[model samples]
Target chain A: MIPIVSDLAPLVCGLLLAVTGAGKLFGRRTAQLAANTVLVRVLNDGRRAGLALRAVGAAELAVAAALLAVPGTLLPGVATAVLGAGFTGYLGYARATAPESSCGCSAKAEGPIGVRSFARAGLVLLGGAAAATATDPWWTEAARRPGWSAAFAVAAALLLCAVSADLDHVWLLPLRRLRIRLFGNPLAGAADGPVPVAASVELLEQSVAWQAASPIVRSALLDHWDDEGWRVLRFAGVYEQAARGARPVNVLFALDLGASIDTTSSPAVRVSVIDDDTDEMVPVDLLAGMATRQVLPMAT
Target chain B: MSHRQNDPGRRGLDRRRFLTTAALGGATIVGASALGGLDADAAFAAPMPSLDPAISRSAFAEGRITQIKGSVLEVAGSHGDQHLIQLTNATSIWKLRTTTADQIQVGDGLYARGVDMPDGTIAADAVWVNIVNLYCTVKGIAKDRLHLAHGAQDHAVVGHIVADTTTASYLGGALTSDLSRVRIGQSAQILGAWRPADDAIDIARVTVGH
Candidate 1:
């Protein structure tokens, strides 16, 4: 069992390398994808990143071919080990410098570097180490024990898919989708719950009242409370006094809570300006010709 | 927030009607056509008024909240500046939904528009917290959530789908509340608000099929 598994390690690693290298070498989005990786920063040029990506891909393919064609040779295994070590170091640098950048190891993987990436790199290292000690080729082992070899290959393929974000849409997402369909979604009740505060803000921003008072109003919401059925939004503002300059004020907006973005109901909004010094309600009539006062000649 | 009224079409006329009707009244609470003329592109920040520019600058503050002191938030601006944001009962706090000031936490990013008080404190009017515009891929889908994969600092973001609030634009078509068109593995740009408590996002709009 141990000997056969050891022999199979090189074959499995070679297949992964072949797939990953092909994506880097032949994928139409290679250059675009490389730009999203740490390679662009490491190489110090966008164009150089693409070149580096292709070079790594070529190295992977060569190692893969060597592992497959000459598995018993110590030289191929040593070369695979060297490549694996380099990959591990590169992944570490990528994780540290650009924690959010994609591994770009597989070229197909766009997901950020995580535990799975380190594990994949480790697998390559281990596989290469095992391949170095392998006496019989993977083909010979498979021919000698066909059923065991086939089952092992399938299991290895599934494990590879589990770690590969590029293949998530194929199996993992479907499984998750199936689970969500069967057991019900985790986020189902949230939508049916209360309307978000943003909806109210959106409704307020659209109202004619908001348009009228916006010129006087300044600042984002300072605080708000539920007064009866209305949501009151407050902001900092200044009342323009023509040549007298602007007086610091607080803008208050009372919007009907029943209104929401989903509903077709027209948002009814009321505005008030308070004198910061006097604490008196500044009449809205002062700003009569504000943005909302325009009389459109073409109105129905 | 764009109000480019270049068209003389029906939509433009309706916008003008919405703007003109009850625009500036004594009561300042204009109803009727004020609410009636709103289309899909509801007046977000209608044509910028010819109001004083200095007043606009003094009334607005933007940056990350470095400290939360009671109802007052200490903000460190994007530039080299600091501000004290004062929140009161009249202030509307929007995280993803219209929420209270208590929903706001330290380190949350915000855009504040308010009165620049004599004491240098900004009496906030509207506060938007953690407003995020993310270009992501729908890695997985649930009944009420879209598992988004973004490239920025947050790689995997759980995007909550609000029933009535979350709208989808498919193949550059009309926006609809039907999220069924959002497929697994499709790339999308989601406009949302972040939840600091759970690190998830409440999606406002998801643009897909591009």
Candidate 2:
């Protein structure tokens, strides 16, 4: 039973390596990963990085093929151990030096290096070491005793899937979604009432006043406040027509909440340019004539 | 806030339904009002144009240049898709600056946005070479480089400051090529060209302060 379990480790690792290697070799993402990630910096240049990735991929495929076909070969087991160790070391280096870099272990796996990546690498290393002690191939051992061997293989694969953060969408996310559906999403009732600031901001963005003032506005959403039944949204803008040449001013839009009207369609939104230098409000009628224009002019 | 606001019940209608109805009705009212002096009959009779959903509006592609044959560039996408990009006189190619087409090299990461041609080639109007805009936090500062934590995951990023190109914008102010003011733990937005194959980026501009 010990030998059978040990042999099964190499089999699982071999399959995992084969998938990962195939992704590196044939997948379109390999080029980007090689070029954009830390591989280039560590490996010297882009061309070298590409070559290195391909070589690793090729080596992995060869080892996987050897392990799967030869079965009881000690050479493949030793090679697997070395490869796993190398992966662990490299991942560690990447994590410490370039945490922003993607692992590039698999095609679909594109995220910053994290603990799960470290775990996955460590798992491979452990599997390789365990396989080195096996007397016979897992398949042959399983053929002799079917029940426990099958169970071990299934358990090992499931464990690998669980540790692989890249494969989470496959098994984990769906389970989470189902659970949410049954129990209801916790955030569903978070927003009860009283118009959110985001909603107010969205309404401001869609307003005609915003369109007219956007060109002069240099800064985004400087400050916002509610005053006299109106939500005032302020932005930093250049007041070009100032007496003392062009100067920065606070552009405020007063949207009436009392009207209970969609500000997007409402023509009553008032605009004011406040000069900080003099503390004076300059009312602007930039969008005054816009309301009388033709509406819903062909969707094209 | 009043309980009436909390209850979300207005004029005997549910909150969601009321909001939806008000939005739609307001839009209709606005449209009618925008018709100038046009009568209601003319406003209702106006023809509404149909939008074609099948139209492909894909204007951006990011990947490495695999093959460059004449004015055509064969790009291998980050995903398992291949893209052919055509360069014209109007197509502006930028590496670190406003450069010509000759600067574009194979194995260089790029982002091109333009009209997708009928023959599946993208007629690129603009191509930014190795450009990356990152919202990062200053984790540490060294003599030569600044260690940054970028994205929601706080991924480590090394930013190399170019003497000529690297500039800083403080508190929505004008850009200045001074690094002395930059401090640790400050959140910064950096625009720079990514060094191919490296986790490091050459900083062009750093904007600090919200």
RMSD of each: 9.5, 18.5
Cα-based lDDT at residue B137, candidate 2 = 79
Model 2 CA deviation exceeding 4 Å by range: A26-29, A107-109, A208-220, A235-252, A258-264, A270-300, B1-210
Best by TM-score: 1
Docking class of 1: incorrect
lDDT of 1 at B91: 58
DockQ of each: 0.16, 0.03
TM-score for the B chain of model 2: 0.66
Worst window of 10 by summed lDDT in candidate 1 chain A: A187-196
Q: In model 1, what is chain B's TM-score?
A: 0.63
lDDT by residue (tens digit), candidate 2, A98-155:
8777777665545687777778888877877777777887778888888988888899
Error of 1 at B75 (Å): 8.5
Cα lDDT of model 1 by residue, A1-300, tens digit: 288777988899888888888888887778877888899988899899988898888888998999899887787777778888988999999999887787787866466788988888887887788888888999999999999999999998998888776677689878877876787655444434444444566567656666666666655544455545766665656688867576767667776655664564456666667765565667657346645566366657
Q: Pick the candidate with the highest lDDT.
A: 1
Candidate 1's C-alpha runs over 4 A off are A26-50, A241-245, A261-264, A286-300, B1-130, B141-146, B151-155, B158-210
